[model samples]
Target: MAAVETVRGLVELTRPVNVIAASVLTFIGSFVAGGVTAYPLQTGAAVAATGLAVGAGNAINDYFDREIDRINQPERAIPRGAVSPRGALVFSVVLFAMAVGFAVTLPVVAIAIAGINLLALVAYTEYFKGLPGLGNALVAYLVGSTFLFGAAAVGEVGPAVVLAVLAAIATLTREIVKDVEDLEGDLEEGLNTLPIAVGERRALVIATGLLAVGVAASPIPYLLGYFGAAYLVVVVPADAIMLYGVARSFDDPTAGQVQLKYGMFLAALAFIIGRGALEFGGV
Candidate 1:
């Protein structure tokens, strides 16, 4: 009981799991660029910056989206009274400040990426959320940028670019599915999300097509001699899972989106395994 109630107590607004995952992406980027071991300070700073930035983004998004969540996701921290909008905004600002501080310790390229991401996070809810497909694209880019930021922190940002593109496409799929899931609430709020603008079926179809493209290109890293056999082993199943999730989205959007995220996470793990094995195990 204590473990479930106390130890498991976590802040929903910050989306801690996603924060951690973004940090992993930063580390993976550095690793892929072959500078993670050599540039410890830069790698660590990049990871820290990515995590804090993701947290700040999530909190501020929730702060600005309180009204929408009150209808779409009443159980969310802001809508459920667990966290006030003002408090969330303040917390987001603090996190953003910390992220910037860490980012400033890195190279100029990483700092530039962080600055752009910070501005995007701040503007996403107010300026982009209502636009058809654009909001999803912005969020997708943010998710993928973690890898680029990490790679830039260490040195070259080439290898991670492919990973970023794949991640972005997968994230785009999930975002469209989520928009479809929230169609009713979004409609009530007069928000013109992708599903709202393109219609649910068409939106899901687009998302599926995007995911298919991503899956088809998932082997680019291996073919380019960036990763090894382990990557192929893991990515094959990950691609299958993502394909299924997108297909299922047409029927059960909520479940489909959740599954898509799980698959995406698995795909991310495959990248780490693929690269680590190639570098260390000679696999």
Candidate 2:
């Protein structure tokens, strides 16, 4: 039981849920680029590689944010003394190596992308994370690249670019909202995050504007005929939810943040369903 608890703590240090989500996005990218049957091995490798990279990034983030998290999230592994900072760093390096190993098995494009993303993840945590807007953009780019990485794994990158753009916008909005939610702790830590640099209200406005842009662009895929009517059916509601979340942020940043998270997940689901429906005739 003690050993199991230790293992669980280590896993939690990596933010397993977020890693799983990244893996799912990678698979969705693969599905969007070409059906699963077309690139099963490449898709599987991409999912594994992306998940590991995300997990490593989270672990390193926790290591760097140990002090901030001690105040904002004491229950986290490092803050709770379940994992030491050095141990977490070492674990993260190992995970990054494994991710790169998996990526090297795929096409050269996947290898190149994996290398660049890994560096970006480190740079974000070490330097950019304290800068206003730049940090948010870097994180958003990483999220968006998961789809591109998937497409690259199979040597198909055309349509995935559109999806990547949508993902980046949605992620940027959510990251800003999260900064707003963590403003108090971040300010105390001397982190110049968006909310800290510009007051929370102003940050909320920026986030809302970004969300609006994403909502407006949500229909582009369908209009471009990349996706069918089923995409519109699900994506329309997803966009509406995001818009409502943006409105709610004016009054309640935390609640709006939660809503945006759910909205992004729903939007990704809509993409999968829409694409599947078009390709498999209602999968």
Candidate 3:
């Protein structure tokens, strides 16, 4: 019973779903770039590395933010006493080392990207996270790189990269909404999130504009003859759902739960559509 509880606590602390999401996007991006010639083994290993990096990053963030989280999110594992800060930090280190090992199984590029991912997570947790727009952009860049990492692995950059970038924009847009959701907690901690710094109304407007751009940009590849029509057909509704989520958030900014889920859906749709189109189009 003690071991099972400990395992569950660690699993919750690591945020496995978020890690898996990164891995899935990375794998899909690699598949799209490589087309039919994609190496499943290489892609799987890269995804595993990405997942480990993401999990480790989360743990590190929890360790560093334990104090802040005590006030802002007392239910978090460390703050709730389910895990100690030192234990979390050690767990992060182990996961990061495992991620590096996994990265070495692939090309040098994967290793480099894995390092970048870890660094970005650290920077975000330590400093960037308090800097309003900058933090949001950093998160988006890291998310977008998963796709670019896939492309680099296969020695190609194509429509998949564009789609991934658009997906990142959508993610950034939703992150702003998340900031609004946490405005009270952030303000208590002196964290300068966009909603707090720019005012919630202005932040909402910016989020709306960004999401619009993301939706419009997502289908560009198909429009430009870079991908099959099916790509647009699949992504359009997903983008529409994202837009709806953003719009709804305007009514209740604390409803980030909706936006976050919608963002995840958008990413999943992008991956699925990108992969299906690339595979069936014979590109």
Best lDDT goes to which candidate?
A: 1
C-alpha positional error of residue 34 in candidate 2 after TM-score superposition, expressed in Å: 0.9
Tens digits of per-residue lDDT for model 3 on 1-283? 7667656767877898888778877876787676326577777777878888888888988887787888778988888777878888888899889988878776676667767877898889789989989999988888888886766666565646686787688778878988888887788888888999889989989999988887777767666655666666667677777777888887886574475565556656655665577657643
Task: Compare candidates 2 and 3 on lDDT and give the better one.
Answer: 2
- Candidate 1 stretches greater than 4 Å from native: 1-10
lDDT against the true structure, per candidate, is 0.90, 0.88, 0.77
On residues 1-283, what C-alpha lDDT tens digit does candidate 1 reach at each position? Answer: 5333321222577899899988998899999999888999999999998988899899898888888888988888777666667878888899899999999998888889999999999999999999999999999999999999989999889999999999999999999999999999899989999988889999999999999999999999999989988999999999999999999998899999988988998998899899988998988
Q: What is the lDDT of residue 134 in candidate 2?
A: 97
- Listed in order, each prediction's TM-score against the native is 0.95, 0.97, 0.91
Q: Over the full model, what C-alpha lDDT does candidate 2 score relative to the true structure?
A: 0.88
Ranking by TM-score: 2, 1, 3
Q: How many residue pairs clash in each candidate?
A: 0, 0, 0
The deviation in Å at residue 15 for candidate 3 is 1.1
For candidate 3, the 10 contiguous residues with the lowest summed lDDT are 256-265
* Model 3, position 247: C-alpha lDDT score: 84
State candidate 2's TM-score: 0.97
Q: Please write out the lDDT profile of model 2 over residues 56-166, one tens digit for every residue.
A: 999999989999998899999889878888989999999999998899999998889899999998888789999999999999999999999998999898778889999
